[model samples]
Target: MSAARPRVLYVTDLAYPARGRRYGDEDVFLTSRLREHFDLALCHPLDATALMDAYDAVVIRNSGPVLGYQKEYDAFRARALGSGARVYNPLSGKADMAGKQYLLDLSAAGFPVIPTVDRAEHLHQLPAAERYVVKPKAGADSLGLRILPADGLAKLAGLADGTVLIQPCVDFAYEVSFYFVDDDFQYALYAPDPERRWELRPYAATAADLEFARHFIDWNGLDHGIQRVDACRAPDGELLLVELEDLNPYLSLDALPEEARDAFVTALTASLSRFVHAAQGTQEARETLIPA
Candidate 1:
């Protein structure tokens, strides 16, 4: 509404020490480029609520795991929703934005996600494997993840209580991620060796590969926002959904070639612009409805 350029409050945790990725480096590079298109200010996740009112939109980049500051994050979410602040991701995401329960929900709905069971009694439905993966329902960044032998399955019955998700440990060949912007496929990257997840290389996605990734994107139903579809290539040569990250997904722009990186930035800039415009229009509509 001001005569100045649209301001964006770029929310990120520049100090977050990720396992194999430099969260700060990527966000720095992104904000530097984004400054060219809009008036931008970088702030820590905890400060977003205090500073967001001055910006046109809040772009959540690598803000680290929300679990670290769940209470503050919840407060920020409530404020953003209540104030109708223009959030880049729009806060409508149902995946990690909410929790890991989507895995069980999708699995039960017959999605191609890895078989996930939240109840202890459902353990019998899982494939018989030597080991199983147990992770907290509210976990992130591999936190509280455990691997137990098949014999430990019964022990998990007492631990389920709907706060944990159980899945058979899959011996996957490799893990790949498909990055998208506003429902459009951007690029694919894969860890050729399962042991090193962050060592990524350009992956040439086949028609079927794109199709598989698109299924989850379509299911998410986000009209505009960035999303990452994480998947692992199973031993049987099928791709299974590992996770659908719609909330502040880290784009490994450093891994992409110069041309691809530029294209992605361009796509992102345009998307942000569209989001700002749409939000402004909606705000104006609401103002017009009120008695002036």
Candidate 2:
């Protein structure tokens, strides 16, 4: 890697045993290609804060769930935000990047998300269901997720604590995901059988499908970085948001056609280059404004 090129600290957890996904292989392929445009160093998420200073930007990719390393993740965010370190995904995310609070916020605003309520007082607002899903607000990759009967859900989450989000389990036709780079659509995938969630295949996204996905992306308002908008088709034939994963969302690139995958990489490289340049310009402007 030449010093003339921007240096990127690419973060991933190669040993993280994520179910139904090969985090290591995907990142290896991506970084190899990205290295052509920028100087790159691979590091585990645990080592990011320590090593980030040497790089022009930190790329968080396939780092697995942060639930296990909450303290470290928190420290990384605090340090990055305060120090103005350029972090891809930028840390201004309102969705899962922050937590499940936005689900309730979106639900309250009626933005096609699964109806989410975090406290006991709001239980009456939820749709009637035999069972409800309860999961941690900080959850990822299904960690700390549970399903409880209607009578038990409120008790399970301890409504007073508000640490968990509750939603009635919906019987959906299929779960579909829309991958995006900034505001641009990259590809879409779906599970034909709801029982086989990870058995994804390429989906022919309709106009409405693209519009549905873009709403959240527009809401997120990130100028750069990759995002995966996960959703499900309801029995009523409407799509509802399941998650807006801005922080280290695993891209199911292996499922895409070779051409599409290559295009995504091209888009990613350009986006990262722009992001790094923008950050550099902003840093320069800030320094110029400082008093001598």
Candidate 3:
């Protein structure tokens, strides 16, 4: 008899109307390819927690912003953690998975991120700019984001308290993203035109670029799953962190050439296999310790 293939519950919102992207087509393509390796089933983010127990692992992909279903997402996280459910990307992420708080933390540590602060007193910490960007700490997808002038700093003070985050608007030459499978680099994409972030093209990453991206990946310390390091090329020609997306990051697989796309799928498939086997091993070990 052959060993059973790992059963995976893939979470996605196929109907999500993402700006400048096709969430459905991307997820469909990925799940189709993934089905070749696992016993895969697709479900919406709201339904994942209910169905996750039936599978060996849950893979969250293109699920859209959690803000839309914050209550359900919180429940899913609590249950997954409580049950030791195998969630790809694991819940240990210290970056965007938690919230925009990581930006403030990273900025204070001088990690080449755009300076961020939640309190009005710390506004001086950020470099002076014509405008500042303010958004909710728990926000995503540019939802609830605002740009304000110096006189508009009062908005941060009137907030019920720590419910928002603030950052100075950065003028960057362009935006680029580095995609990684686990700790390994797979490929890179960039938007040459700053005004059009989603018009992406394949970018050949330099050694210094990779080093800069890897620094954050290393900081994240995820042992499995895909991560995207979003950065901008500053006026001084240095990369600065824009966001570290570890949760349901939209992989622009459609933008890649066939060869690169296939390579990414291959890398992801291998990573999932390893992650499944590792989770199975841990479960078996735990079972052995339980009283019969």
Q: Which 10 consecutive positions of candidate 1 have the poorest summed lDDT?
A: 1-10
**Arrange candidates by lDDT, highest first: which order?**
1, 3, 2
Better of 1 and 2 by lDDT: 1
**Looking at candidate 2, what is the lDDT of residue 69?**
94
Task: Give a tens-digit lDDT track for model 1, residues 55-130.
Answer: 8899998999999999999999999999988887979998999899899989999888889998878878899999
Q: Give lDDT tens digits, candidate 2, residues 1-292.
A: 2238999999999889988889999999999999999989999999998998778899999998888999999999999989889999889988889988899999999899999888888888899998889888888899988888877854755753688888989999999999999889999999999988989999999999999999999999988899999999999999999999999999989999999999999999999999998877787899999999
TM-score of each: 0.97, 0.95, 0.96
Order of all candidates by TM-score, from best down to worst? 1, 3, 2
Task: After superposing candidate 2 on the true structure, give the runs of residues whose Cα lies further than 4 Å from its correct spot.
Answer: 1-3, 151-160, 284-292
Residue-level lDDT of model 3, residues 216-258, one tens digit each, is 9999999998999999999999899999999989999989999
Stretches of candidate 3 off by over 4 Å are 155-160, 290-292
